[model samples]
Target chain A: MNVIVCVKQIPDPALPGALDGATNTLKRDGKLILDDSDAYGVEMALQLVDAAGGGEVSIISMAPNGETAGMRTALAMGAAKGILVSDPALQGSDALTTAKVLAAAAQRLGGADLIIAATESSDGYTGTVPEQMAEVLGLPSVTFAKKVKIDGGVLKADRQTEEGYDEVECALPALISVTAGVVEPRYPSFKGIMAAKSKPVEEVTASDLGVTPAGWAGAGQKVMLVAQAEARQAGEIVEDDGESFGKIVAFLENLKVI
Target chain B: MAINSVWVFAQVTNGAATTGTLELLTKARSLSPNVTAVLGGDASGVAAQLGEFGATKVYATGDLAGKLPGVAVAGAMKAIIDGGDKPDLILFPQNYEGRDVLARLSVKLNKSVLTNSIDVAVDGDSVNATTPIFGGNTLVTTTFTGEGPYLVAFRPKSFAAEASGGAPAAIAAASVPDLGATGGAKVTAVHVEESTGPKLDEANIVVSGGRGLGEADKYAMIEELAKLLKGAPGASRAIVDAGWVPYSYQVGQTGKVVKPSVYIAAGISGATQHMVGMKGAKNIIAINKDKEAPIFGIADLGIVGDVHKVLPKLIEALKGR
Candidate 1:
């Protein structure tokens, strides 16, 4: 079975002020890492291919020019090939538009028996794309999956729910979006790192996929990004004395916590 | 042709209706009088309650005794989309089940899915959704420009619960196609964490302990206060990793995101990850030994004192209240 994994290069969320001052957008700085959830998806796909007695695992990503480092990381993790769908036109696209571009690219790749993605993007945190891509490609999508396995041409997965979890089974050529607990993504080794350089990467443009600027723009909703986020003010610290306990009690009482 | 109506996924568990079902119905009622509440379960007499919640029409799919919610929601959404009764907006609660179903339905229907929205207002030919980004530090208002139904998942406990007062409407049982083979793994067993406190996500008041408490045993102070308030116990990532508290109660970037009305952080330094989970809280209180703990910045009330001393006193004050 052939598997495809959709990966994203998000900004290091640990950094302060990771947004660009001029564009009012997230600044890809410090480090461009594979979205943590997508790494799990990639790992799941690799395991599936290996279990199937050697199938191909293709890594797909959409990002700005600086995200090539992330693409290379996926290659080093053991994907047979990489596909990067990047262009200046694809910038500023919201979750919906991003799904459209990805769906179009997946279609151009001649499709696959299985598609995998993280539950949500760390930066966007939308958690909407995998389902959106499945809709666009007319496939069944099972999301928030904690465990997945392929048996007898059927894909079985354990999905997490509030009450607990439910076991489910679906046929091949389906999409699965994994949660964090699914698998621990393996780090690249020296041998894998050396092999990644020779791995062929296919690059595609939005225009080449017939996704025009207007067509690629989001249609459902408009997002009004706030100009600035006001930082919280520094607070006072009372001394660690008997008097401090009274002050703390008084504060909680005033806040109605008492 | 007349616009059909807006659809709200009226989720019911163990025959009890969820709070979000009513909230979404209220929002849908405001958008258009033609609102349908689709309930997927065999719970008796739920249609009458749905009508009280402002549902003009009620569709009960049947009893979902052995069915997965993801399967039920996808089937119901598909039926609504295919019955020549296309909804302009599809609202879901940003809960675990809601997210799963909406994510699949959005893809199946080719609609834009928006999650963690705080507010939704109807605009001409579209809806404007307000969702927080970069945690609750900033709010982004989004509108979709396409022709499909606008899908949104509202954060739980964000909207005020509206009273459902109207008379019952004639119930209709809608037929939904079963998407063969749920496709994926099946659950073998469930291990529920045994605890005796209010659920952290649903609690109105939450008292969270952080690393500043210094040790796992010190959590007793935090628990005492929670008990006094008849609220739930929560913890920061610092405490969870130290095994001071269960991972279920941990609130941070990697744990549950909650929006309780009142949140008290004891000994928490307020890392951004921890802040993102509770920043939507209506009011915040912080108590720490350090004068410059980051949590104090967003806190409406702050007491810079040792939590070991401060929490005991606060618990005493609450006992007196």
Candidate 2:
């Protein structure tokens, strides 16, 4: 079972992220890391490949300035190879355009039996690209997956819902967005890190994938304004003087929630 | 470019229209007098409710049974749109089903979607959507620059769901086109987590525990407090990621956005992502040992204490009452 995981290289979310004043988009000129969310997908893909006995796991990512630092992390985690779709024209692409570019790159890889991705990226947080990719590829998608198991060419997933979870089953050549914490991602060992440095990572452009005029030129949406949100006023602050619980109870009583 | 018509992708759970759908309907009605509800499941039961929220028409597909709603629902809406329906905008809630349908529909229509919106304003052919960034510290207003049938997904509780006391909406049957292999997913079973008190999002009071509680077992204090107050237990993403609680119990930007009457956060040191979820609460009470935790910035009452001592005392005090 060949699996292709769509990974995202994002500005380290731990640090502050700033938007470009000119483009009204998040600045991406800094060093990027593999989104922590996508690690669950990559780990799950590796496990699925292992379970299937013998298949390769490939990583596909779109980043600016030929960024492969994020892809190198995924490759170290046991993915066979990597494909990075980078282009100056792909700077301001929206999610739909992203789906198109990534979808095109996946097709260029001659497709896989299954594709996996995080339910959403930490930086973008659009949470729609996996399904959009599935749509562009005309494949079935099962999202918000908490648990996944493969049996007899069918994929079964415990899909998370508001109330609980739904047991969903889909055919092969499909896409699934796995939720975080579903699996424990392993840290790359020294040997694996050394191997990842030599792993073949093919870099391509929008024209190479036939998604020319990508980014803002192909985007259907534009940011009109960016402003400070109305700040929530800070109320009273009290050091716990041992009777703090009484204060809490009194506050609840005032709200009539007690 | 005037929004001649607006459509809401309605969702139904437990045989009734969801509150999020009604909220969207309420907002859609305000934006355009001509409001249509596009439902994926049977609309027979909720047609009147849809109308009460100002949806004049409900274009629905027959029962989906257990099939995944994305392919069939998007296909049904595509059929309606292709059959001469000219809605300028389609609104969706940022929920599971809504996101699924909106994503597929964006691809089907070759359009883009703006999601996690808190507000939308109609401006003569342009619909500006306001979305929070950096965890509600800043807001960005985006507008559709493309063709019609704009798709936007709003977070739940973005608007109130008020009924207009209108007649039952007229229902129009829409067919799901042959999906071939694209509609191959099926739901084989459903497992609802057993809950003893109010749901986390629906509760009037939410008591969430975080990593400062020290260990997983201490989460019981949160449940105890929530139960004593007749509310629901919640968790910070840290604890949820640490496997102390289910992801469903998480309250954060990536989890459930909750706006309870009173939200008591224990041990959670207000990350921007966590703050985005509960900042809308009418009353915020935070308890953490660190006095400078960012959570204190927006907290209505910040208790500079440890959850270990504070939660127990609070639970005991509430029980005594």
Candidate 3:
């Protein structure tokens, strides 16, 4: 079955992430890499398409600056092509607008039998985009999938929950948001990296997709204010005085947790 | 800000409202007097208790027994809103089921969802939510720019839950829509992982282990201590990835967000990824050999000792006590 995976380019989370003070948005002017979370989707999509025998995996991403660096990494992992929606108007777009644009890009790619995405972006963590995309595309969504399988064109998964897991079944052309470590992501090989350069990445804009980036369509959630979250003050730090064992029990009892 | 009505998605489990639902209902009381609870399944058993938390009315949908909540409950709520029974503000608990319903409703109604809200305020005709972003580095107050029936999901323990000593609320039934393809995502089977003691999320005191534990065998100590305290056991991504524990026991950014009364970390160096999930706990105790470990930076009690040596003595002492 053909697949379209939505990946994101997020600032390297290992270092630091800053918000544009003037715009109240995540600063996107630095180096970016494929969000580690999305790697599972990209990998899962490639494996599914390969298991399906000869179907292709395409990618759709919405980022400013035509961020092809992250897209190329996915292509190296075996996605056939990519559609990057990069426009100044699309900047600061909330999860809804991002989903709309990606939905449009899915149509531009002639749609797909399966659409995969990480449960949420590491940067935003809204956990709403993939479901919104499924709604916009009018397809069923099975999110937080821990294990996925295909049988007779049916997309089945073991969806994760608070207590346990639910084995869910849906049709093709459905959307599935996978949790991390669903499968061990494979790194791009030397040959795959070289071929990724020639792999085409078509760029598009909101207007081209027949969607406007103004008023409600631009950003439905307006940022009223952005400030540093009050840092959690470190509590009493006592060196383990052999008496520490007794101290811990008293702490739990004092809190009435024991 | 005289609000017309406020609604809360009161999640019901085992014929009763979840604690998180009660918390949302309690907070909704401060927002408006006309607090309605939108529940799934038979809320008749707990409708009276909902009133104690300030719900004036309960709208429980029918026949969602075996269907996925996202498809059944969300479809029902969409129908209710479309019928012009919309409220000014809708509160959702930031959780698996809550996220599913909120996202589906957001798309169905063409509205925006403000997530991970720590606090919510109403002004004139708008509702604003303060959410911490960038992994708790900063806070951003967000408000919807579009039409009403605004959606906001509160993080766990974001608000206090208390009874207002009110009478039982009236119960009404909502017709569950014929969830055709929407309910196509049917759960075929449920596999409950073998776990001991209380659930990590529901536990009042949580004890978590990290990579500092040399191997998987040492995790027994973490569980032992948790069992002693009548708490729950949790693990960081390092051990979970190393195949020491199941993903359900993992606590971090992508895993469960727990805010137990006290969180104890054994051998964890406190990576930021792990910090974001448990930092909200009321009291944090870190046990690591490294005094400069990042976990100690935010820990309420830092025990600069080896987990191997400290946990044994701690467990032995607790067993005797």
- Candidate 3 runs further than 4 Å off: A214-217, A235-258, B178-180, B192-194, B241-243
Error of 1 at B218 (Å): 8.3
lDDT of 2 at A60: 98
Query: Residue-wise lDDT of candidate 2 within B64-106, one digit each (tens)?
Result: 8787888889999999889998799999999888899999999
The TM-score of candidate 3 is: 0.93
| Of 2 and 3, the candidate ranking higher by DockQ | 2
Candidate 1 per-residue lDDT, tens place, B1-321, comes to 123577788887556677778888777777778888777665356767777877878777786544556656677768867887777777888766677678668657756677878788765555678876665677667766667577788876557668568666457776657556442323345445556767788888898999988878889888888888878899986676455665567786556777887888989988776897888778787887777677878887777777887777767766776
Per-residue lDDT tens digits of candidate 1, residues A1-258?
A: 789999998776566645565554567645677876678888899999999987788888887773567767788899888778888777766666787788787777778889999878777777777876776676766777778999898888877666556676766788888876577688988898899989988788888787764333544554555534565554454556666656656655676655
* Model 2 chain B worst lDDT run, 10 consecutive residues: B62-71
Interface RMSD of each: 4.4, 1.2, 2.6
Give candidate 2 misplaced runs (Cα > 4 Å).
Answer: none
The alpha-carbon lDDT assigned to residue B120 of candidate 3 equals 88
Best by lDDT: 2
Query: Over the stretch A1-258, how does candidate 2's per-residue lDDT look in tens digits?
Result: 899999999998878779998999998889999999999999999999999999999999999999999999999999999899999998998899999999999999899999999999999899899999999999999999999989999999999998899999999989999998889899988888899999999999989998875578778888999999889998989999888999999999898876
Write one digit per residue (lDDT tens) for candidate 3, span A129-202: 88888888878889999899898889989998866888888877799999877888999999999999999999
Q: Which candidate would rank higher by lDDT, 2 or 3?
A: 2
The deviation in Å at residue A193 for candidate 3 is 1.8
